[model samples]
Target: MTETPTATKEKPAHRSGLAAATREFVLIVVGALIVSSILRAFVGQMFIIPSESMQNTLLVGDRVVVEKLTDVERGDVVVFEDPGGWLGQEESGQKRGSVGRFFEVVGLLPDSSHGHLIKRLIGMPGDKVACCDAKGRLMVNGKPLDETSYLYPGDAPSAMDFQVTVPAGHVFVMGDHRSESGDSRVHLSDTGPNGGSPGDAAFVPLDKVTGRAILVVWPANRFDKLEIPDTFKDVPAAAAPPPDKPSISLTPPPK
Candidate 1:
């Protein structure tokens, strides 16, 4: 007698093309967002320019990438939080709907330049910074800074007089549009006894500096890398403080 034919099990059904495609799309989107978020949170972030403070170099609508990977240097453009009451008014007037806000949050759009200030790092801790010498230029650590390369046309180094020495762990910053920027100069009790003042309002603590503006990525025509001007690189370190004189009275001063 012939043996009974063996029974065969049916293969499992394959997933529909549309269903598979949708699942893959969702996964790709999720993965892309994760990478973007990581890059934005630690490597770099994007910010929109809100004012003319950094004009000529940065436009009002320009988008810039601020990198957190390096130490800030004098002459580097930095984005920092409002040191106390620096931002008098909301610089950003962006009115976004739910979708816009969502996109910004997920790193798909640039952040509003709100609650932040961007300026050129001019004076490091202990560096004596002053404005308007005989020829009318900024003096940093006794060296005149020739700012013609980026200073807005027809503007003076500073219309106001200020002399300050950046205090320890702080920096003095100013906008390229000196006339329009309400920078360290605006908060000076006098510009310390005001470097005691980024000791006061104008001097920004290193902690407040979120990142250095590394590149302009928007307004295709305006894209460029931000570099430390040669003038800043050539600035000499602050002179050493003079030693105190010995006491003339009977007892020596306590150490």
Candidate 2:
């Protein structure tokens, strides 16, 4: 009867409920950030193409999706850390703001457009990679590659002529726009012959590879899949060195 006697304070209970909800929201946000960070560190991340090194394949300002789940393969477009002096003088000084850095750490922003280089995997460990033949084509493992499908509109396979067997645990890379790219070709300290490939900073170490660029996600017009062209399908395996470490053939084993 004294029923509505003393009205218990409803404010405290409502305040407690709001506080609990806020905590849950915060935790969810934090947990999401953590998952994104882990994925970026070990699974996949976004990278912004800073230069036209990749050209029509990847233009300036294009956002590329680099995945770390699979092994690097020949014909795969890859993004890697600067092996040494690969970056130009202007690239060394680029930096992101604190806000951008935070986003980068959480996988919301692209990797620093500076420290990474993207190129096609032209040679695998111990594979011989060389320039144009009589028909003006690139050669891999003694077979010719008709690169017309991916090469920039007017770019040649390569203006320079050289051959190098990729050293063990290293890979040889080049840009689609051969003329504009300062790839492994220009960085060679010495050439490789008879399986004696010069590795002195000429090749990119396996550990230095960030991941393969599999997709272009931004600038809707440029949206596309970065796939191994049909040319690689016909590429034969590289012959392993006799009495030496065997090199892995990048082409798929014949079924």
Candidate 3:
């Protein structure tokens, strides 16, 4: 009897299309991750507070979101690149390192070669800003402000005095922690203890404004939209060459 023909079995063929689909899926995921990283690096970023210079408003260890949009108005909190040095930081480390400096050149870094700074917009180009009239209030274009809503409990409006007209294309900035912060007031060449060189007092260019800090996204309890203070409401639009009158000063009370 002839043996029955051996049954033959064929294995399923490998599909090339299936492999291509898998590869495409992997590429898409990788591309997305890269895009997100690039946005974080150049567009908007997050930062953690490393000092108390900003105090109650921005506590140490609090994370904050910084936008790269660069549009700002008065009374906005902002993040900008740091200059060559800041209070007590090592001179070398204070300068924008490779990553931050590189971004600055391309306009991704708003604070120049420095690193980054967060502060409030007080005086804009063509606006006059001064510290304390007889009542111990910051005056912007002859308008006294009511900052009780945001000022830390018991904190003075400003321990120091300053007076200056913001230059065209520049802004005057200050920290919410007036007594603790070394802001434009301390840097005015005419107002400092020595009357030598202004401390950190320098105008920030409008183009350098990165973006207004709209919300506090971290530290769950502090999360809220930063509002424009009513104090700045009556302040006049900054004008070039304030009308020949002294706007602010830092002189101590005579004994």
Best by lDDT: 2
**lDDT (C-alpha, whole model) for all candidates:** 0.78, 0.80, 0.64
Model 3 lDDT at residue 95? 49
Two-way lDDT contest, 1 vs 2, winner = 2
Off by over 4 Å in 2: 1-11, 90-93, 190-199, 242-255
lDDT of 3 by residue, 1-255 (tens): 899999897654566667788899999877766776677656776665555666677776566767666567788777655432334452112445788755544434333313466778887776877767788887777878888777766778788666667766667788887776666665564322323244323665566566666667767988877768887777787555633222334563222
Best by TM-score: 2
Error of 3 at 146 (Å): 0.7
Q: Estimate each model's TM-score.
A: 0.81, 0.86, 0.71
Pairs of residues clashing in candidate 2: none
Model 3: worst 10 consecutive residues (lDDT sum): 84-93
Candidate 2 to truth, TM: 0.86
In every candidate, how many clashes are there? 5, 0, 13
In model 1, the runs with Cα more than 4 Å from the true position are 1-17, 93-98, 190-199, 240-255
| Model 1 score (lDDT) | 0.78
lDDT of 1 at 67: 93
